[model samples]
Target: MDKLKPFPAVPSDGKIETIPFLKACRSVVKLLETFGPVLMPAVDDIHGNVKKLEKIYMENQTEFKYLNGMLLEEKRKMGCHARIALLWLRRGLELFFVLFSKVVEQHAAGKVLQDLRPLIKQAYEETLEKFHGYRTKQMCMGLMEKFRKYKDFLQIMGANDERSESSVFTILPVYLDGIKCSTEAIYNRMVKKNQVEKHIDDAETEKTLTQRELDKIKVEELQMLQTEEKKASQDQCI
Candidate 1:
């Protein structure tokens, strides 16, 4: 939880460290702010879940060394607080991460539309639509009616200058991939492969990105933007 805003690194056991897991989630809640106030409801829910888990973890530090461990123990003891808390937290992270990834992808392609409801709707459908009850889903759609301009959003994400903007975007996907990995590691332990496939297309989303694939994405995005900028510059020159 420093200036780097690093995602929690899952330990070698692939079990999420309790304190770090909570910190990482708080980081995601912070990221949600860049989207503007339209997502305040989601931001609130995610932040609340983090607090829920943190409170329970604080109850017994040694007992809850790892998040997955806490859930497994709850299952064994036939209790549900930790289980339910983590479940909601995981679900919230998936919804937001999926949405953020799509936003970054659109921006990488050199397009950030003035109205982004379509993107918002798509993310909602993919992640949280089926899970929510009718009223919740309706509220979600209503929120989609508004969105922040991309330039202003990027400014909040710390795009102070040309060089810094590039740095911000580069760091974004890496953070996304890190969250993707940590969350998946926790989820894959509990959910079946088929269940995961239902969330993201294996071929499209890669299930998990290797460092090489991550680098490829960054390179491709930068090359695409650079090419577009150069072409526009040439046209203006002509």
Candidate 2:
């Protein structure tokens, strides 16, 4: 059988791919930074439009309410009444469009936030290899720097510092949980592997003991047979 060789040592930090993945994750987050600011302005614009439409609606209502009944009746008796009907229809359409725009903007913003969560999660996971075996200070300081720098993206993603359940801010805990669970799984597997090795060692020891016993039994039988042959030869001589 070939002699067993020792396996190569793994780096304390991680494999060669760890650094590349970390860089990739950083790049992804950086790309997201530009997007959040862009979408925020769109949402603000929608709200502004809503306010303008609301002002127009209120002004139209007030104008109609203040109209003299006699003038209104005179206008109603003529074809000029169609102007009021048209104004009401126009206001209704504007209100509907304003409300619809708000809803659409909200849905778009929400979708962006939802999409950001998975990207954040993936980046967090990618950092795990590099983070492994790091001192608490090193890890915390490094990640904190990143958090501070990219904080705007968080706000843009609708994940502010507030720990709202619907906000992407809550996803931070999910990243932590993933790291913890994966570490525990690795540790558990190592324990099981050690247990398996110990059982194999015990079996090898038992086999050695059984083999030694069998060899001793065979030697004793051979000695008895040789002695019997010697005694029978002497008896034949006599």
Candidate 3:
């Protein structure tokens, strides 16, 4: 390496050498120059494809909304109890869209996982809407729990190498499909009047289990308070 002569005024010392540095820079420039012809065409093709997809999505937006409204109308036709689950589903979908838009915006600006965590968390939190009846609340839980899986998906997406770009290509379809499937299943269970008695029995069983869970928690809390009081007494004696 010492045998190579750097240009005049360039450092000959091992710590600094101009010749190899210039050669490396020239190599990088040449590589890009060679790649330019192939790369530009590919980039243009990708841009065109993206524009087409955007156009299609725009065209379908109205149709999507109409279909969604029809589903809600169907739920409404099913009566009051079904409407309980419907309300949560509507709110959850609204929150998901807003959060997803933010995620897409951040991704478009080339943000990474750190920037995305909060948007995902906000979506998850917002989906947990309040409901009155135990059946309604359970239905809400079932609906939101499906959305909560997206939080886990973000962790998996972080592991993927393509975090810097819009996962819209993958994420959107998966989200839509999951929400659709869950909505259908919940709707079928909640709206079918024939299953009302079965649902009530199931709800009663669930209520009993939930009450038992609350009792256990209270027992544990009471014991913890007693232990603290006993410790205080022992400290005073000491």
Query: Best candidate, lDDT-wise?
Result: 1
Model 3: how far is 41 from its true place, Å?
47
Off by over 4 Å in 1: 1-4, 34-36, 191-238
TM-score for each candidate, following the candidate numbering = 0.73, 0.19, 0.28
Q: What are the candidates' C-alpha RMSDs? A: 17.2, 38.8, 26.7
Q: How many residue pairs clash in each candidate at the backbone level?
A: 0, 0, 0
The list of candidate 3 runs beyond 4 A from truth reads: 1-78, 115-117, 124-159, 163-238
lDDT by residue for model 3 over 1-238, one digit each (tens)? 1121122221222121222322322232232233233222222222333333333334445432322332333333432222223333333344444555666565557655443445544554454332135664445344433332333345433424445224533555444444344334434533232232222322234345555554553454445446766888999999
Q: Candidate 2: where is the Cα deviation over 4 Å? A: 1-150, 156-166, 191-238
Candidate 1 per-residue lDDT, tens place, 32-61, comes to 776766676567657876887788788778
lDDT value for model 3: 0.37
Rank the candidate models, highest TM-score first.
Answer: 1, 3, 2
Error of 2 at 13 (Å): 27
State the lDDT at 184 in candidate 3.
45
Could you tell me the lDDT of residue 210 within candidate 2?
Answer: 57
